[model samples]
Target: MTFRTRFAPSPTGPLHLGHAYSALIAAQEARAHGGEFLLRIEDIDQSRSRTHWEDQIYDDLAWLGLSWPRPVMRQSERTKAYARAVAQLTDAGLTYPCICRRADIEAAAGAPQEGVPQFGPDGRIYPGTCRARVFPESQDHAIRLNMAKAVEGLTELSFVEKGALFAGAHRLDAARLVETIGDIILVRKGMAASYHLAVVVDDAEQGITQVTRGADLWEATQIHVLLQRLLGLSTPDYHHHDLIRDDAGKRLAKRDDARAIATYRADGATPEDVIEMVGLTP
Candidate 1:
């Protein structure tokens, strides 16, 4: 089978070293296997996405000697697709409307000492405040996925990574995905769908065979897998690679303009130097 992968970057900010590292790794992996590499603009957060940043993405990738197979796929242009997926899940009785705000969920669930909320990978685990509420005449609130029924009887969840399969079951720690993430926000209040829903639809639409990115999103794999099963879409393999950090070991951020690809390039850094900086030798 032909291998297919994608480098999906949100255009909310400039492309930093972490972004470069991830994109290069995906590109190299595809080339190494004589597979296909695709570029996807995950600009769903319309509030922050900017045309300037998008242009920079193209410029930075080209400067790094990376090329994608087709015209870039932009998520902002795919809202309708995500809406359809959300509707499908809702029709299947796998999603519900959530009225709770972030603060409300945190207060309801009580504050945990470490990490984010246990439900879903996002950590802002919905406390299911509206789970028992009768479906309001109108859904003015965000929608959440009803994972309780969706994952029933599935004791083990596994996916392929780095030519091997890794399995995780039930909850990540003390919080059960079903109860903690019960009725996750599939749609944000006025928004049609959440990132989890849109991304799953996009991945399947793009025919992506494997997903490679930072390990920080490891928890989100479960959310994607559950969505795929619910939508009857094929689940792709996942490889959560290590994150690029600074001398202090903090994960790279868009605010770290000092590490932006454009900044490094202006400083006379070669593409090979960028690869070396990110720990990708090729």
Candidate 2:
């Protein structure tokens, strides 16, 4: 099969230097392999995702000289696809309704046991309060995956990145793969789809042969891979690149507008400079 990769960005805020780096790398890699580079707008967060931000994504990416293969895909318009996948998972007994609130989890897991609360790829770890409860037919709650049972029939799970900074091809951590990510949420309380479900379904629908994103999402790949297996979808090879961090070593966020692409453009910084800022060759 021909090589295909995508740079999926959530259009909730302005594109930042970090976004530039990832897009450039993905575009360059696709070009290098004579592959197709696609762009996907992860606008699942309807509350925060705005038309302005979506337009900014197109403008910034074009300004940075990063071209997409075809017309971009917006996740907000693909609710029905995500809903279908969720229904399939629910039918397979892989998903359960989670009624536990954030406060309940925090109160249940008082005080840090060992240093800070152990966090995996999907942010803070869930204490699994609603794991045992049998969700009623009329129960209105978020859906959670039965990760423990899901990974039982599976033997080995791994992926490879053709190019990487530290390890060219990284291996998946087996022990932490199952333990750290236990019963992750698939659908939010009122939201139609969750990140895990949406991402996997979108990736499959887009025929993403490989995924190139920040290393911070490395752990989350396991969840996606697991979902692929559960849904009988093909898993793509993954490349988790080093994240762009600020001087304080925190990952660059949308709140840091100073690093926004618009700011850089206004400050007379060229697209090449934006690529260089991400430690990539312009």
Candidate 3:
């Protein structure tokens, strides 16, 4: 199989050093292996995703001396595909409508009898208050995967981590996924699909053979692997690298205007200079 990878950026804000690092790493990996590198616009959050940002993404990537295959995949346009996946999950009895909101789930998860509050991949673990309930058709609610039920007959899981430090086919810590990443959301009531659902679907559709990203998303890989299994999609090998930090010892954010790629370029920084800034150049 061709070792394909992507530099998917959510067109919500300006691209920062962190974004550049991830994109360059993925592009380099694809080039090193004589594979394809694609660019995906993850504009699932329509409210925050702007046309200006999308335009800026193209400008910045081109300025960085990178290019991808034509007809870039945008998550917003792939709602129909995501909807079909959700429908399949609904048919398999692995999903249930979640009526509990963030506050409600947090309160329930933090209840005294609920034991030491365990946080999952999505931050706090969902308390599953609506797991067993049968809500009316008119009820607006998110759809959550039943973690325990989802892994019912599955055997022990393992995935390849091709990062610098965590390389090889590593066995999954099932206990941690069970305890920390329980009942993840697939689709919100008003939204077409959540990140977990849409990303897995997009990766599979794009034939992403290798997923290169930051280590911050390591735990999220567990959920992605599970979804790939459940959906019968090919699981891609992952490369989670170290994150680029700012002077404050914090991860770079899009909101950090000073660190935005556009700002640097406006200040007469070249593509090679930016690459060096992110330590991508030797």
Model 1's alpha-carbon lDDT is 0.79
Q: Candidate 1: where are CA atoms >4 Å away?
A: 111-120, 135-139, 153-156, 163-175
Clash count of each predicted structure: 3, 0, 1
TM-score of 1: 0.89
Alpha-carbon shift of residue 126 in model 3 (angstroms)? 0.5
lDDT of each: 0.79, 0.83, 0.89
Give one digit per residue, the lDDT tens place, for model 2 in 108-173.
Answer: 767777654366776667777787888575877988887777776676666665545544554555
**True lDDT of residue 175, candidate 2:** 57
Candidate 3 per-residue lDDT, tens place, 1-282, comes to: 888999999999999989999999999999999999999999998988999999999999999999999999999999999999988888998998888888888678654455554776677788779888987968888899998888877876778999986787877665666677888899977788999999999999999999999988888988999899889898899999999998889998889989999999999999999999999883
- Model 3, residue 156: what's the lDDT? 64
> Candidate 3: where is the Cα deviation over 4 Å?
111-117
Which stretch of 10 consecutive residues in model 2 shows the poorest summed lDDT?
A: 165-174
